[model samples]
Target chain A: MNLYEYEAKRIFEAGGIPVPPAVRITKPEELAKVHFGYPLTLKCQVMSGGRGKAGGIKFAKDLEEGKALAKDLLQLVIKGSKTESLLVEPMVSIAKELYLAVTLDRERGCPIFIASAEGGIEIESSHNVLTEPIPFPYHPYVGRNLAAKLGLKGAVMAKVADLANKLYKVFESKDLDLAEINPLVITKGDDVLALDGKIIINDDSIGRQPAFKGWMEAHLVDMSPRERRAKMTDLNLVELDGNIGILCNGAGLTMATMDMVKAFGGQPGNFLDAGGGSDQKKTLAALELVNENPAVDVILLNILGGITACDEVAGALVEFMKKYPERQMVVRLRGNNQDVAEKMLAASGLKLYPDLEEAVKEAVSRSKNATKKPALAAKA
Target chain B: MILVDKHTKVVVQGATGKMGAAHTKRMLDYGTNIVAGVTPGKGGEKIHNVPVFDTVMEAVKTTGATCSVIFVPPYLALDAGYEALDAGISLLVLITEGIPPQDTAKLAAAVKAKGAKLIGPNCPGIITPGQSLIGILPGSIFKSGPVGMVSKSGTLTYEIALALTESGYGQSTCVGTGGDPIKGLDYQEVLSMFEHDPATEVIVMIGEIGGNAEEEAAAFIKKNVKKPVIGYIAGQTAPPGKRMGHAGAIISGGKGTAESKLEAFKANGVRVAMTPGEVAKQVAEAIKQPAKA
Candidate 1:
């Protein structure tokens, strides 16, 4: 789960890292009571990057300006995500900016610290970035090593190293997948402040972190309706703008099925992984999710039942088709009681294909035909 | 050579859980030599006639079990794994998913230190067809033969295995390397074992989007593996940065793309298949060809 700037800054403060004092405003009227000082930065809270480029951040020199900007930002939708709240903080005067972060290096299977002399918008293109792998329970001296690598010295250097160590401590203790302080600013007085912060908690570690469990509940409030419904059903559903709805078992096979649908000239409306060993209830939930989508013209069920028995899947499809007799479905069930599943489907006036290619081709053709019939009738 | 067979004595960790009990029955049904089971409080109870012990050490001491299949939940997987390692179990097949990456990294390091083999933390485990089963893969779809298989997926592996079985090619051993960023064994490591195994003449490698494991395996196959190798990659249509269900199945920083992996395989003299059926066809064709000089 990605944390808002305000939340991440709160964590940073708890970890003894210096951050600019900030207040969160959920309503525009709340901005009137804000007394952080003049020259405040109003940052729109959304779970996306490039908020500044998208006009989600505005600089207000006074209270009146801050209120107006907060109102505008609250109403703004950036990158398909609505701005739910704003982080109001006193803008800092920076003598210099640097970047620092800690994230898992998946290839090496370890945590690594990334640092760069250049920070802010152009950090991605900066050539001065350096990375150092940190062992578990990392040594405090490694922070100074990274600080020195970024060309820091004196009291400011010590402060930056101390901040780095604290950030790492927070990252490990919180089970965060990533903890980043972009544009760690050095004020004119040589005091370093984390200007902006971002942290992503590892989803698998959510069970162990109660605070993050609460954060996940808040995170779900921002999801699309379909996504929320899928979450309730424990289904992995990603909504897309297309016509054919795909239902399959396993992540890899689900993706492969979507590719096959696209290859066969059909647009996939959603990606749904029914997961392994899904019973009739989960299968029905999956079907209901796809059926709820108005854009879905045809539902395709592609399951290679290894741990999942085909007969159980067949039973669920039978139940769903019996209730929604008008909905079109194309299924290819294989492995583990496939013969029984095939027999069950055959008796129900539904056709089951043995090959995935055949099932995909049939579903694509059926969807094309279903769309054309209405258009032709309207023309006639 | 793949670390499991009929003679390999087995013990089950977290044997009282739903997954452990279910797959234990299936493994035993397939004639696996399951000698004992271990559940913390359910000691002395028998699951499917296999004696239960409180700890892995006790189970190993009693049954002389060489391998352990872990079915503990994610939070406890590392501890369970450590117990198995401490008991001197030679091979550990972790069937549990959702283990934290940090825990897995620590577990991998410990496994290396103990000179033990760890199959998966989110994987389907290893299966030597018609001999022994250490994971939850459906046994009906596989048959013992000259083909050796390794995959990063559960159902996709079954799909390819079914395709191979239907195409008259059976498997010597099939290993699911688990779909996590960090896992016990990579494709290269599993491929190395298959390369030297006298039973495995043809190798079928299944990979998905994410990680450079396939590229590394392709390099290994190019230089060291003389067996006919056929490969298939899933998630060709997966959008970048999307999790795609699996925790490790995301394309990050313009790397670990299915197209890139396929291109790497083609460059390394490994036949790449676009789909599961195509994989079986390529493997069959590879089998018909004479040995490379």
Candidate 2:
């Protein structure tokens, strides 16, 4: 899960990293009492990147300017995410910007620390970046090594190395998937300050890190209502702009189904994985989600039941199809009580294909036919 | 001939849980020689007539089991793995998913140090057609034949195996190496074993969007594996940064794309299949051709 910049900076501060003092304003009206002084930065709190280019960040020279910027930012919608809060902080005058981060290197099966002397906006494409693999216990000397590799020396090198060690400690202690400080700036006073921060807590480690539970809850408030509903039902649903809705039993299968849909010249409207071992309620919930979308001309259910039984899915579909007669559906059910599911679907006036290709082809053609007729009728 | 066969003795960890009991019963019914079970405090109990022990060491000592399949929760998976390793199990299969990558890193290092083979902490385990079933894969889909299979998905593996069996290309063995960022065994390791197995002829590898495991396997095949290999990668249309069901199925920073993995396979002379049915067709065609000199 991605943390807001304020949350990430809080963790950085707890890890002994230097950060500019900041206050969170949930409402534009709350900016009236702000006393952090002039020349402050107001940043909209959203989960997406490129906030600066999206006009989510602004500067204020006085209280009136700060309030005006806060009002505008709080009402801004950048990249489909609205700003729910604004981070107010004193602006820093930077002598230079440097990039520092630690992330899991899956290829090497270990964590790696990345640093670069050139930082800020273009740091992602910078050629001066250096990466160092860290093993268990995170050797103390590794930070100094990274500092030296970034072409640092003297007191600056010592301070950078010390800051790197502290960042590593926070990364390890918080069970983070990623801990990044983009533009770790060197101030005019020659002191280092983490200008911006990003932390991704590993989803599986959430149970162990109880302190992050509240933060995660707050993060959920930022998600779309449909996403939150899907979360409550334990379904993986990602909405898209297409005409066909896909429901599958596993993640790989769901994606493969989407690929097949696209291959057959049909656009997939959403990705909904009912998960293995889903019952009637979960299946109904998934169907309801897809049915609610008017853009979905057809719903395709591709289930390769291993732990999940075909009969359970068929039972749910039969009930759902009966209630929603206008909705078109094409199902391919196989494995684990396949005969029973086929019999049940047949009795419900529904056809179940044993072949996935045939089912996908049928769904795509049916969706095209259904969509074409409406346009022809309107023209006539 | 690879990791498990009909005569291999299997032990179950976390045997008292729902998944453990269900798959254990299925494995035993499929002719696997399940000798014992381990559930920490449930030592004196017997599940499906298989004796249970307090620890992996006790189970190993009492039953002389050489292999263990774990079904514990994710948080306890590392401990269960360590117990199985300390008890000297030569081959360990972890059926539990959601194990933290950090824990997997530690467990993998220890497994290497002990000179033992670890299959998966989030995998479906291994199956030798018509002989032994050590994981949670559906046993009815498999048939004894010449095709050797390895995949990173559980249900997708079943789907592919089913397609192959229906198309008359039965499998010698099928292994799901789990879908996590860090896994115990990789495609290269399993591919090498399939290369030397006498009963296996063609190989079918199912990969998805994540990591460089498939690329590494392609490199290994180009140099060492002489057998004709059919490859299929899922998630061709998956967007970047979204974990599509599996924790390890995300494409990050323009790497681990399905297009890249498939291209790597094609460059290495491996036949690439767009669908599972296509995979079966390619395998059948490869089997009909005579071995290259």
Candidate 3:
């Protein structure tokens, strides 16, 4: 899960990395207690990057200025993400701005450190960057080696090297995909500070990290209720803007189905993977998630069951059809127990498509047809 | 030659569970010699008439089984994999999903260090058609032929294999390399084996949007492979930065894009198929012609 800057800063501070002291303000009125005061940088807390260019940052010289900045930033939106709060910090003078990050290099199947003498948004394209692969347990000399490559020496060099060592410890311990301190600033006095922080915890490792589990709970508070329910149900769901709801068994098949829906000129309302071996209850939950979306006129369920039995899913479809008779379903069930599934669907006065293309095209046309009819209220 | 034939002895981990027992029966029906089962605290029991043991070392000692397919829950996957590896099971097929990447990283390194190979920590197992069936793939979709297949996906493996079968082009061996970020065997490693194996004539690579696996494979084929390679990439429609069901399918930092992978394949002289059906047709056509340099 991606962490907002303020959240990431908390992790950085706890890890012994130096960051500018900051206070979090959810509203303009909350700024009264922030006594560090004057000429503070008010950074809107949004998940997406390029927050500065997107007008999510402002400066304030006094209490009234800070309050006004907070109010404006709390109402601002960066990219597609709205501001949840503001991080208020006393602006600092910088002698030099550098960048560094410890992230998993998927190709190498290990973690790597990326550092640059020049920091900021353009650091990604900077030729001055140095990358070094880190072995497990993080050998200490690797940090010193990276700092040496950055062309630094003396006390400042030692500090940068020490910071790199500590940063990687957090990366490994937190099970993070990335722990980045972009624009890590060097003061005139040679003190280093992480001006911006970005961290992404590995979602699959949430069970092992107690602190992140709490973060995930707070993370869900901003999501739509349907999305929250999907999370609790173990359904891999993404809300897409469209009219046709698509459900499939495996990750690859689900994506392939979504591509097919788009190929046939039908927009998919959502992408939901029921996963392999989904039984009756999970199948019914998946169907209800899509069927309840009032914008979704048709749900196209494509199950190429290998572990998931075709007949079991067909039974769920029959039960769901009984409850929501008005909803349209385009079903293509195949693989294990397909013959029994075919017969089961036929007995319920429903039909199954034999081919993927035919089923997708039929759903697209049915969705187009349904747009002419009034959208019924989702069953309360 | 195919990796495993009828005589290769196999043991099922977590064999007393519902999935392990069901697939064990399916594999047994396909004539795979599943000699023993392993489930902690379930020793002395039998699944599908196969004897069960509590520890992997005990099972290996008794049956001399060199291969193990795991079905343990996600949290216990690391322990299960290590147990099998320590017990001298050289080939490990991890069938559980949702294994934390950290555990997988540790497992991947351990497997490498031991000079053994792990197929997946979150993937469907491998299969050689009509000879031996392992993991959750439907054996009916495959038939023995000159084509060797490797894919990052499970169902896409079945979908394309079915298409190949329907078109009268069967497979010599098909391996679902697993969609996770780090797999035991990648496209390049599998391609080398297929290139050397006499049974495989044409190669089909199924890749998705994420990672440099496809690009790396294409580079390998351009240099080392003499066999005709046909590539099919999924997720042309997937939005960037959004996590698809597969964790590895996310595109970030201007990397792992479908267009970039497709371009790499084309630049390296690998044949690209836009859709699943096209993959089968291209493979059939490639086989009719002689092998390319």
lDDT of each: 0.87, 0.86, 0.86
Error of 2 at B181 (Å): 1.8
Task: Give the residue spans of candidate 3 off by over 4 A.
Answer: A220-228, A376-380, B291-293
TM-score of chain A of each: 0.92, 0.89, 0.92
Q: What's model 2's overall lDDT?
A: 0.86
- Residue-level lDDT tens digits of model 3 in B158-270: 88888899889989888887878866878888899999999999999999888888889888899999889998888878877667788898887878888999998899878
Q: Give the Cα error of residue A194 in candidate 3, in Å.
A: 2.1
| Candidate 3 lDDT over residue span A276-305, tens digit each | 899989999999988777778899999998
C-alpha RMSD between model 1 and the true structure = 3.1
Per-residue lDDT of candidate 1, residues B1-293 (tens digit): 37788999999998888889988899999999999999998999999999999999999999899999999999999999999999999899998888988789878888988999999878888899999988899898899888999998998888888888888889999999888898888888889999999999899898889989899889888999999898888888887866777889989878889999999999998887887778888887888883632
Q: Compare candidates 2 and 3 on TM-score and give the better one.
A: 3
Model 3's C-alpha root-mean-square deviation from the true structure amounts to 2.4
Worst 10 residues of 2 chain A by lDDT: A371-380
Each prediction's TM-score versus the true structure: 0.94, 0.93, 0.94
**DockQ values for all predictions?**
0.66, 0.66, 0.67
Residue-wise C-alpha lDDT for candidate 1, range A73-111, written one tens digit per residue: 999888888787999888898999999999888777778
